[model samples]
Target: MGWFGRKRDPQDANEMLRQYNEAEAARLAGLSSGSNLAPTTVSASFSSAEFAVEDVFTITGRGQVVTGTVASGVIRVGDRIVVLRDGADVGSSEITGIEMFRKKATEAAAGTLAGLLLRGRVDVARGDVIRTSASA
Candidate 1:
């Protein structure tokens, strides 16, 4: 009959959850409008500026696998050739080696040249997206 004596019904729990989610969404939306989120956008990444498909771009600085859900990883300088089947998930593609520089010339399209590990295939077109695996 008192405060401790009342059991929370499912409807009350659902309402509480809904309110929490709405509040959280509002907070995140506000935060994203600030500067910190700006630097992480794709347009802010080196990939957008430094890479060009069919034109083999290079980065002098080092890179880490900061974020990924890769099946395998490799870095080939030239035609060292670590082939991946089209549409293969990040976890299934095998990266046979690492190539810091292409001793010979290699080519890639701006959108097709993926990350350092070749995390995804050179298959993402101008506007396609491959998300990091949820479990990764």
Candidate 2:
């Protein structure tokens, strides 16, 4: 019966998969902890951050939430930002909250996709660009 092909040991395959899972978990933990990473400091005179809106919605008690990728710079809760469309100001809003992957984040850096809760009447739309005011 064993002449057709080499017999595979079930225990060995299970052990190899377990080892792979453990290694992957360790790698994820290191990435989450940001081991050996350097801290980045944005200047006080640095102009406001920027984001491109991908989705916009309103949370009952949380207000307007705009989810998008950070196009440039950094954004933090409480930063004032302007919503623009067609090179015109639609409105301005204060960031009330910021979140990434369902976890509250203090700051969202460039290239990160984050959801921002805005406090204002700024009507946000898909494709609109959000930018921090130069004087902010």
Question: Best candidate per TM-score, number?
Answer: 2
TM-score of each: 0.25, 0.66
Global lDDT scores for all candidate models: 0.32, 0.79
Residue-level lDDT of model 2, residues 73-124, one tens digit each, is 8998888888888778899989989998679998999877789999955789
| Pairs of colliding residues, candidate 1 | 53-108, 53-109, 53-110, 54-108, 54-109, 71-90, 71-91, 75-99, 77-102
Model 2 spans with C-alpha error above 4 angstroms: 1-46
RMSD for all candidates, in order, please. Answer: 16.5, 9.9
For residues 1-136, write the lDDT of model 1, one tens digit per residue. 6779978556786688679868855764675577474213222222212221122223344322111111222223332222222333323222222332232223333322234334334442322223322222
